[model samples]
Target: MAEVHRVEEKTFEFEVPVVIVGAGAAGLVAALAAREAGADVLVIERDSVPRGSTALSAGLIPAPGTRFQKAAGIEDSPGLFARDILAKAHDEPDGDQVALVTREIGPAIEWLADNHGLAFSVIDDFTYPGHSARRMHGLPQRSGEELIDALRQAAEAAGIEILCDAHVTDLWADATGRVLGLGLVRPDGSTDEVGCGELILACNGYGGNKALVAEHVPSLSDALYFGHEGNQGDAILWGEALGAASRHLGGHQGHGSVAHPAGILISWATVTEGGFQVNLNGERFSNEAKGYSEQAAEVLRQPEGLAYTVFDERIAGIVRQFEDFRRAEAMGIILTADTPEALAERMNVPSGMLAETFAEVSRLKAEGARDGFGRDFSGVADLAAPYHAVRVTGALFHTQGGLVVDDAARVLTRDGAVLPNLYATGGAACGVSGKDASGYLSGNGLLTAVALGRLAGQAAGRRVAIPASA
Candidate 1:
């Protein structure tokens, strides 16, 4: 755990109006927001280059009522988006939080594109499991690497200063959790203390921490961590130390579609678009359509902790627009065959059993019935030759739990009291994904990151501006 300094009477090297920790989407967005609101902001990143969980993601964000949706003539609203989030999470999250993110996310992303020049386009072709509409927006490639790079470039262009390779190890504050300054340690063991009138924690969750993973999400304790290594629970731990409230520490985003051994993220589109998963026994284990996050545990429970995503050529054409899918195609990691038996042979699974699984799928589609696992295959088109498949395994993408925050993104105490001069955003704050991976709707992570991040920055900026005026 990072130490919390009592700061009875401390001196600082320098000061900034607003200080943002972590240079990922959340931090950069917060910096940009604060800067836009007429506040001087400083962003501190542990890594030399800014690539947190945002970089590892598909870079998609779910936002309704945006111009993109309007241009596409897709009728949508924040209420619909909020409803989808609750439906996916089984209404386990705070309804107000859901409403807050849903309401603000559209404007947040729109501000980014209009002001920061992010080339966002709505993904309307195929829908994610829980989303009710085609509201996902992303850059041209739809890659997180591009998203983060674009944000970094945007921040640089905005004249916001970013301190790289500076790992925050301590929070200097009073007992009230009113953060005053932070201690940063460089890779070369150098230290600096910088004071701030307001602080926003955008450092994200604890997915990279093995002990935390074991303590909370024990089922995925041994699962592959696909998020940024910098997600070490710094915000959660420090927030706890500062008497801030934390919730649903076990909640996380887990994906069952990571390409096995090759370390590539296979998009869930393959499964959502009439594809299915089969274990090494070449049998369908669970309904693959039950959301990819929950499918992680399902995949891990299978033999050898591995599963294969089986789809068709048409599905491949639909998914090729994604950068990761194209990379997998270029690497020739996706196996294809003219028939089920031939594909089973290529996948080294039992041909008879694989054929049986295919037959079952066909039966369900033909009968328009639900499977034993509750997956409905009636609406989707039937799979045809040539067949395509990719061997995959489950992995932890990021934890969806941390300190609780309010509408203004102010960090709160266990008693529901706000902590002054402090805010948490992104994975640093409790997410809307209920209490487990199953609750994760696609793009939930980025929704809060960009939405809550902007809100926090604006509130912090207003707070600072008010006092200066006074």
Candidate 2:
């Protein structure tokens, strides 16, 4: 056995049936499931509880074909959801993991509502970019905090031990490469070791770890400006130490840029509002009527990977019409100017071109186009000035690519063999992100995280342990 270092101040060991490395959606759900299976669960989070990627997110949970949908007269199934996700995967996602998520999503949603006090309001037939149907459900808190709150309550009531600010620095195993436990660093910088029957890594991606970001996704070397502060990719590295292989290490799931002050992601809202996105040259780029992800990609292709959304005084009404817009903009998502020329000047785009584009949009509307930026643009309210513009660039929420796993959420090696006692879920696992070619389905992340977490949690909990000497 490797030398186990003991903590001086507290020389104690707590053995649990399972040790979960992250406290985000995946880790918490895993803990919940493990406890349900009668396992003593220890959840070690790098940050305070409910303080990771999920907390910073808009809590859009997408699980197709539920009581919400059935009651609303919408017909769907896990098979249809799976098919749509696979189609979106476009051959890039791990086929097995995708299948697993589709299978377990319904149960996961049920679990959340039934056990975790997660109250959801279903938007009847509301559809995102890549999804075929409007099956996405928004959480009550409308933020990741709500989901975390529910998960935390359930886990606590289940007697799960949660260690916040306790970072697991390494994995501990026997000489035979049989997994044993983890080496954790407490918040005080002192390290301690905890042994467990199984270790679950739900520590999220390396969006904030610029070094890791540069190492994995070099394309965004300098572009990795924002993400959860604690997302240092410890989970991936710890898995590697245990001989686990990971994919899409540096892959980026781009988010639409949040505005300057509020900096809340606003891709969806921007697209929904009749906003015109102008490049640095003041030229309209992309099909504005398209999804936010597509718009974000278009923005990232520009100079400095930045653009501006120009709108007029009517933006106030539009903002009122769409709560997402108001929330995002009120959170510093919108950059307003009193005049079109001033807005153009502030955004550094050509004033003449912006004026011309605005005029063209008006002309197109007059000509019977439905909306601006290649939509019908007909009969829509023209953008009357008191114009405003907000700077936008492609931001990233999380990467979808990760360690390939089977339908059971078992992590697989490059040769396709499963890593013994290993499983993965959440953004840390490979997914069908860009499968849609246009973009991924909105709320896909949460959907997959909760579903796969439950699946992996149950599977890991049920896994029969091999004797240490065997």
Residue 78, model 2: Cα distance from true site in angstroms: 2.7
Q: Please provide, for model 2 over 174-261, each residue's C-alpha lDDT reduced to its tens digit, 9 standing for 90 to 100.
A: 5433457677777778988777777676777667777766666555556534467776666566556556677755445666555544
Write model 1 residue lDDT over 230-295, tens digit each, in one string: 889999999988889999888899999999999899989998999999999899989889889999
Model 1, position 127, has a per-residue lDDT of: 88
- Model 2, position 441, has a per-residue lDDT of 60
lDDT of each: 0.93, 0.68
Clashing pairs in 1: none
